[model samples]
Target: MPASELSVRPLTVADMTRFIEVDNIAFIEGPYSPDLVAWQRRFLEVERSIGLFDDEEQVGGATIFTMRLSVPDGRLVPLAGVSWVSVLPTHRRRGGLTKLMRHQLHDLHDRQAEPLAGLTASHPGIYGRFGYGRPTQSVTLTVPREHNTLRLPQGVDDVTLRLVSPKAGLEACRETYARRLTSRPGMIDRPDFWFDFETDDLDQLRGGQSKLRLVLAEREGVTVGYAMYRTNELGPAKGEVRVNDVYAVDPAAYAALWRMLLNIDLTIATVVPGLAVDDPLLAMLEASRYGEPALRDGLYVRLVDVDRALAARTYATPIDVVFEVTDEFCPWNAGRWRLVGDEKGATCTRTDSTADISIDVRELASIYLGGVTLRSLAAANQVTEHTIGSVRAASTAFASDVQPWLSTGF
Candidate 1:
C-alpha cells in the first residue's frame, strides 16, 4: 500500500521477460517455450503495454492489441484487444489490478483509434464493472471415436484428402482461412505473426503430445479445406485426436475433414476445440453422447466509442429509438442517444428525447454483436425497457442470423 507501488508506465519489448514472468505466475500456467515468448515479445505494442511497478519490480501489467474485428453485415471494426492482464500474488489486493485496468480504459477512451475494446476474461466477473459484456461464446466437442459416426452431407466421395507438412500446406490452408474470416461476426483479423504462432509446430512446444499434422481437402485439384491436428495417446489402448482448427468451403469438404479425424485409428475420441456455437458438426451428428460439448465465454467487448461501434454495423430490421446507456467506467458513453436506420445502414447520435430503453453499457455490449438479444437481457432484468414495444423492436433490429464467433485468442 505504499506510494512506490503506485507507479505506472508503458512496457517495452525489453521488459517482456519480467512481464511474462509476473504474468505466467498470475495465470499459474507457463514458463512458455522461449520460441513462443520471443514471437510474443515482438508482437507487442510497447506504448500500449501498461505496467504497474513497485520501484522497478513489476507488480502488474496489461496491454491492448490493435486489431480489426468483424461485426454484423461483414463490417470490420477497429478492436482494442486487452491481453496479458496480471497482478502478482505478492501484490494482491493492493489495487494493482485496478490501476492496470483504469489506466487501460482511460487510454482507450482518450486515444479514439479503436472504437471497441475487448478481452477473454480469466475470471468472467472482473470486467463487467469496466463496461465489458460477454458478446461471444465458444464451444468444444468431444466425440468418442465410435460415436463420431456423423450423418454427413453428400459429396464426401468427390473431395480428395492429402497429408502434407505444415510448411508445405500453408498456402492451401491460408486460402481456406481467408474465405471464412469475414463470413461471421466476432472474428478478429489475423496478422502474419498469428499464423506463425498457430502453426509453429515445434517438437519442443508439443509438450507430451505428438507432432502437429496437416491435412488438406481438395476438389478438382483445388484446395477447399484444411485441418491442423495431433494425436495424444495413453499407452497403447487409449488415444485422442486433438484438432486445433478446421475450415472448409462446402458441406462435403467440411464432412471429409471431420470424418478423417473421427476415423483416426485407435483413438478413443476426437476432440474438436474452439468453435462457433452454431458449428456445423453440432448439427451433423445425432443428439447423443458423441457430441458432448462444453460451452464457455470467449470474447468480452466494451464499446469505447459507442456511436462508432453502433454505426459501423448493419442491422437486421428497422428501429428508431433512443437508448439511455450508462457507463460510469467510461463516462463519455453515459448518455441518452437516438439511433435511426437498419438493415441497409444506421446512425446513432446524442438526443434529448426520452429514452426507449435503459441499459448498462456492459449489457449493451452483449447485444452489440447480435449474439445476445435485448429481449433476453430484459428477461433477466439486465436490460430495462421504458417505451411500449421497445424491447421486441430493438431486439429484432439488433439480432443477427448466425451466432458470433471468435476462434483466435489474444
Candidate 2:
C-alpha cells in the first residue's frame, strides 16, 4: 500500500457497512449492533462523510454534521460539527488521518456555509496541530444529598415543577432548549434526531442505570426549564443520580430545576456531568463539603473563516488591535487582521498594519469565546505583546460576562 495510492472521498450509500467496520476497528470498539447500525443510517449524512481508502479498501473516515453555534451576544451562526473520526490501526502513521482532516477542512471551506468547525477531542494533542483550540471548560460536580440544600430564591416557588415521561415532554423540552441555545454562548442547537436519540434510544448507553426521568418547570403554562437524569445504586441505603442534560431560560426556573435535582428522593448524591465553570449552581449551594470540581476540556473550535468568525461576536469593550495569526493548516487565516469593535458589535478586516500581538490561530480560537484570556496565554508565553497596554485591552474586550460552555457535545 503506497502512500501515493491513498485517496479520500465522500462515502456512498453502498459504502456504509464498510465505513462502520473501519470506524469500529480504528476505535478498537466491538462491532456495533444491528439496531445501532440502523440508527446510524437514519441520522448519518453519507454525502458529508469521508472515506480514506488504499486502492479499493476503506481504512479511515469521519463525518460532518450541519449545526448552529451560539456565539457571544446570542448570535447563532452556522457551524460544522466533526465527529466519528478515525484511522484504522493498520493505517496509522501513514498520513491517512492527516489526509482525512485536511480534506474535511477544505470541503467545509468550499461549502462556504459554516464559518467555524467544532469537535470534542478524544485525544488532547491530535487537533491542535490542525489549528483547533479548546475554548470552553466543562466541570463535573458531585454533591452529597445531605449537602444539596437550596437557599431558594424569592419567587422561585412560584414556578411549578413536575415530572413527566420523556415521551410526553419532548416537544416542550425542545422549545425550551431552542430558547436556551439562542440566549447562551457555546450552546449547539439540537436536531430532532438528537432528541430522539436522547429520549428513546439512549437507555442501553446509560450503563444499566434506571430509565431517564424528565423534569420540567413552567409558569403560566409556558415551559422555562428541564432536566434529564438517571439514577444508579451506590449502596443499599444510598444512590447516585447522574444528570445527563439540563437547560433553564430564567433565573427562577434555573433555581427551581436545581431544587428538584437536589431533592430527588432515595438519591444520596447527585453527579452533574457537564456544567459551565461559572455555573450558578456553585453559588446557589447553601452549604456543602463537596470535593473539588473536576474541570476538563469542552469544545475545540476551528476558525474556518477568520473574518466572519471574528466579526460575528460582540466585544465586551471598545478596542482596536492588529493580530498576526499563524494558521498553517488554514492558510487563508494567516497574516495580519485589524479588529475594531465594542459591546454592540465588531468588524474584522485584513490589514497591513503592524501587529499589536503575534499569535497562532489556535491561540486565537482559544480566546474566541472569551473563556480563555490573552493575559493567561501571555503568562504561558503563548502570546507575544508588542504594546504595553494592548494585552489588557484585548483581553478585556473579548471577556464574556458569563463563561462560555457547551450545552451539547457532538
Candidate 1 TM-score versus the reference? 0.95
RMSD of each: 1.7, 1.9
lDDT of 2 at 365: 91
lDDT of 2 by residue, 1-410 (tens): 44656789888999888888888787777557878777777777788899999889888899988888887778887878998898888777888888988998887788776888999988888999999998999888888877878767777988998899998999988888887786657899876688877888454466779899999998888889999998998778688888988788888999999888887787788898888988878888876338357898999999997888899888888989999899999898899999999888889999999999999999999998887999999999999999888999999998887888998888
In model 2, the clashing pairs are: none
TM-score of each: 0.95, 0.94
List, residue by residue over 1-410, the lDDT tens digit for candidate 1: 54554677898778887887788889887568777677668777787888889887888898888888998788888898899999888888788877877788777768767888889988888888888999899888888876766787989999999999888888777778888888889998876667676777766568689988999999999999999999999779799899888899899999999889988888888887778988888888775355678888999998987888888887888989899999987888999988887878999999999999999999989999898999999889998888989999999998888999986889
Tell how far residue 187 is off in model 2, in angstroms: 0.8
Model 2 misplaced stretches (Cα beyond 4 Å): 1-5, 288-291
